[model samples]
Target: MLDRSESALRVVVRSKFYRSAFLALLIAGIGLSAATPQLTLFLVRDLGTPLPVAGLYYVTNLAAPVAGFLVGRWSDRSHDRLLWFRVCAVIGSVGWLAMAAAQTVWLPFVISTVALSLAGGSMAQLFAACRDELSRHPTKAENRVIATIRMAFTVGWILGPVLGSWFGGVFGLRALLVATAACVFAQMLPLGGQRVERYEDPGISPLPEGRRRLDHMMPLLVFTAICVLAMTGDTIKFGYLPIYMAEQLHVSDSVRGAVIGIQPLLELLMLPAVARLADRYGPLRIMTVGAALGLAGNIAYATSSSVGGLFLGQALTAGLWACVGALGVSIAQQLYPEGVGTASGIFLSSIPLGSAIGGAIGGIGVAIIGLPHVFFVPAGLTTLALVAFVVLTARLSVRMKA
Candidate 1:
């Protein structure tokens, strides 16, 4: 009876670890999404910046990827991943608070870089810690776990816009920013002082020294390239879709908000099924299908003439994003088991890198050609990603079979 009771206690404790991690991710997502959607608008309305300049402000978000990679690499070497998370959360909270107080453009710009980067780094560390914990347990399904995390993030995305709009409407953007800081600080409470056991796969043997470096580097490179392309296209759509709805379609702010909200809501519905499929069929295959969907969705966005068409485009994009969110991290963890933290950092960084490039290019495109035409660029980029994925996967399969 004592043994049985002890076993049950261990099980409960193990379950709590995963639950806490998921909750932290959910809260992080809420904080980020709440302020991000309105940042461009805030810059324009409050700071008197031009639309193009406001859009370009996202280019400064390059801090996220840079910090994500560095922190991830550090976590790989460090024994206590949660400690890094706590430090990052504190830094991010300070940054958000500062942003709330900033009256000048330069202060927000400089502070945002520090705050967002640290926050991103914290998320990367959290993911790496979760992956390590999953690996240690082995009974937990990685794809399912990843899917749950994605769903949590999707839920946050769903709530974030509503909260942002409500808080901004009721109080102001500064209040919304302050709320975001509070959310970031809240994550530390659940995750602080929690340490996860690290596990390295015993099945993988050391490669021959001559071929070792090349073989190790190739997978990371392939994963990074694919992620960069996918993120670039996605960020372009995310950054400019609102503007396109308002300026090109002459939609009301409420309509634009609804349209923006639809994608994540659909994603929340799709992620569970997508995770099941990814676990069964493999993340790489599902990711390919997702890339194709992204291409199609971008094309739809570029050509749509009616509100119905816009809805269809966003629906398809949501499905694609669900696949990416569910599968991408799982694939990264699988590919680089030893350096999960470093790989995750690299993978997470792709978002900011893509966002920076996408924002800069989208801003320029909007200035040169038109708002609707900017999506064409992502459509074209997605096509290239598809082509590369097909060719690379085919060769990889042949090698594996050999």
Candidate 2:
């Protein structure tokens, strides 16, 4: 019995589909994280855009969900998701190159917006691919696989910023952009004609003719929206916290970088345990706890008057994100297994959408009230999201019992 179990375990551990999906996601994460920290800085410092205007640049993210939804729907219908994946990588590479060569503010704005949007769409496709891969191997824990992918991403983030800072500091932001483009293109080499098998469950029949699919999907959709609202707090912090540290706290660039890097590093420590809890308790429950932690973190930020307090708040914030970031995709994949691509797209799009709206609002709030006071806005948003989510789960439970 032990030998048979061990043999089965080896087969799962050595699965090509699982290994390939994780590798692709890890590389993509490296490319994205390496460039992300420098983007707003490049615009504000190099291109002479104000913080508020730079914040407005994220407004372009409003259009990304549409792009994601379309690409995801198309990926669901397409035979070769790998083909679409390669195309997206190419598009993202070109966008990075355009950003590298951009002389004017509008050019970078347009390129960043379009490139990141395409990248977001690509990510949706990738999640669908991963889910398809996961479907083929039933013995593997689905949430665990998802958490492992997120760990890959967190690992990339841990390395990317340090690399970006070193590269950008030494060779300039253009060189950094070029390197990022290379990283994006490098993700393509690993594919090597590997195709994701489409998912089809034999036991589950199609929905009846009169039942609207949208009706069945509404609860999850509402849940996604609430999650987005909660995410806006993190977005606000990402958009403005570095600036706050630099301008308000008068920290040096190196210190600022360390402060920014610490969150993901701490997150790396938390993910493995969080993944286990998610597997045991369900993703939503873990997410709820994370949301509460996020609220506390935001409040800490609002009250913080020193660098130590800021760091403390950021640590809590990292804990919050580590939970949601891993589980959000898992929940979305579970909720809409039939259209994993579309569901994942919607889930993926929420990040940027939340960031765009939050950054815009944060920028305006900073301009009006002051940087220190802006933290309260996100706290309020998170509170509302948590309330809505609790109500939603309660209603769902009542219905289930009935």
Candidate 3:
């Protein structure tokens, strides 16, 4: 039994589908993370925009994920996933092209909103494609594949800020925007061969002859919604943390960079362990713990008076974030035995949706109530999310027993 179990583990570790998924995630993380941190800096420092105005600029970005969700659902009904994905990438490139030409914040902001929305659409399509691939090889459990994806994203983030800082020093922010667009387009490269059967829900009911398996997928949708709310709190740190550090505590750029850099590296290192825990303890438990961590981390940030306090708080939050992020998708995948394409689109788009919400809220808080309060909002939200997560898990557990 021990030898058989060890062999099964080895097969999972060496699977090609998981390997490709990890690579796609890695490329995504490195590219987006490298470019995004510097966007506000570009607006404020380079374009001579005020912080409040920059905040508003971020507010407009929330529309992208909504559009992505809609487009993804539509695609599930009728559309070529790869073709639409490529088109969205092209649109994302155009957004960058416009940003490169901007002399004012409005121009870049307008383009970024559209471009980001398109990028969201592209990501939705990409995930649906990945889901299709995973389903083909679904004989094995998928928890590790999900963790591998999150780790890739963290790895990208590790690269993102370093690259942003470097480009900000060399070619200026506009050039960096152009470079980001180029990378998004480059992500369009052929991933090579599709293996899984595309999932299509029969209808909405399993009773009727041609009816769909609605009950099987409903739990997944509920979980996805819960994840969306939890993620909203999780995303605040990235979009606003550096600015918070700089403004509230008078942190130097170098220190801010270190704090930001530390997050992804920590995530990259800890994800495998978190993945193991998700498998052993359960994804639900892992996610609940993550939400609690978010609550604590945000509260620490809100009350902290020192730089070390901030970093430590952020690090704690990152560990929890990794746990939830790694497990959430796996849970969602398990929920949808059919309609992997639709489910992947819905599940993946939640992150961008949450980020959009967090960014808008964080931007507003920074502009009005102040930086310290930014953490407070996320803390409150995360606390609420923890309650929701607990309730959801409890219900799921009950269902499993019944």
Best by lDDT: 2
Predict model 1's lDDT versus the native: 0.75
- Angstrom error of the Cα, residue 190, model 2: value is 2.3
Worst 10 residues of 1 by lDDT: 1-10
lDDT of each: 0.75, 0.75, 0.67
Backbone clashes, each candidate:
0, 0, 5
Off by over 4 Å in 3: 1-17, 44-50, 78-81, 103-105, 139-141, 190-222, 233-253, 336-338, 363-374, 398-402
The root-mean-square deviation over C-alpha atoms between each candidate and the true structure, in angstroms, is 4.7, 3.6, 4.2
lDDT tens digits, residue span 1-402, model 3: 112123323544576645655565666665677677787788888889998687666566567546655666565655455656666778877777777777876887677666666566665566666566555555333455566655766777777777877886899887887887777777655344534334444553322123345566578777777766666755567666776778767889889878877766777777877776765667887888888887888888787778888888878878776876677655665565454445556677677667768877776776787766678887777778889889888888644211
Model 2: CA > 4 A from native: 1-13, 44-52, 204-211, 246-255, 395-402
Q: Where does candidate 2 clash, by residue pair?
A: none
Residue 384 miss distance in model 2 (angstroms):
1.2
TM-score to native of every candidate shown: 0.88, 0.88, 0.82
